[model samples]
Target: MNRKIIITGTTCTGKTTLGKKLAKEFLIKQIDLDDIHFLSNWIEKENTAFVKDVNSEIEKHLEWIVTGSYQTLLKDTVWQEGTLIVWLDYPLNLILRRYFIRTYRRVFLKERCCGENYETLKSTFSSESLFLWIFKTYWHRKRRMHHWKNTLFSHKEWLILKHPKEEQKLRNLLYDN
Candidate 1:
């Protein structure tokens, strides 16, 4: 397809996995916002810098699968330009469970994303735990995505993949092309 796709969802909804798969199938670049927005020691980049970097990256490619929920920095730009937006609207329990498990594994294994390692339990539990962020923002994110679907992004090919089966079906459909 010629569309510039964006796969977005709350934390732990498999946006990265699906984005990677779709990008590979389409031979388009995949831009994981986390990698660009986060710095070493798990610190976030400044808003201005993040926006500039994201816009620069977006400019470098004709087609891309941009994945993340960086609403403050990139939402308008991404939505305005994206041809397709895929929202993974999974159930809350599923997302929370996945978030917990993924955080647990990453913490235990000391997994790093883009060279930024997570902090200790004290730091994580205090104010930086992704799990906590998930719990805090899940409903808000759901509502926002729903509203966007009905309003700003209505004309876009907005696909709501709510389950693994549906995700797989879409994957197969896209891959077959």
Candidate 2:
């Protein structure tokens, strides 16, 4: 198959982790939309610029694994090109556990991300924090993904893994020959 794999989830659902592993196993480029979508200091890239850059990067590689979804902005480009779409719709409790661990490292440990943006405590608990965003969008994103999967994306090949216990199954699905 001509592999144009896309790993998508709301937040902290191991999208990037899975994308990286798949990219390495397939020896294909890993395109992270988050890397392209953020400017320095957590600022978002302009929509036009983000779309242009994402399209350019995707166009550069015929075989690639992509992480993150900006479906509203990129439905015509990346999502359209995906041959295998992996949706990690893990439970909210699992999502929050991952979030706390990640945020602890990023905020307290001062880990840099998204082109030099560091998460501060102020940002961690604030309205704009990823923590808050996760809570706000978890159910919404889940509904959206299911809606898209059953409707707009019904024709596509989808692998929806709903829990961490499905790890072995996931590996077998993607890794076994």
Question: How does residue 158 of candidate 2 score in lDDT?
Answer: 89
What is the TM-score of each predicted model, taking all chains together? 0.89, 0.92
Tens-digit lDDT string for candidate 1 (1-177):
566888888988988878887788768899998889889877889998988898889889988888888864676787788887888889988887887777676768776654365646666577767777888989999999889889877888878889756987666645654
Stretches > 4 Å off in candidate 2 = 175-177
Best by lDDT: 2
Q: RMSD to native for every prediction?
A: 2.0, 1.6
Model 2, 68-150: lDDT tens digits are 97877988888888888888988889999999998899888887766567889988878798878888888888888899899
| TM-score of model number 2 | 0.92
lDDT values for all models: 0.80, 0.84
**Cα lDDT over the full model 2:** 0.84
- State candidate 1's TM-score: 0.89
Poorest lDDT segment (10 consecutive residues) of candidate 2: 168-177
Question: For residue 62, what is the lDDT in candidate 2?
Answer: 77
Clashing pairs in 1: none
Which number leads on TM-score? Answer: 2
* Candidate 1 RMSD computed on C-alpha atoms after optimal superposition onto the true structure: 2.0
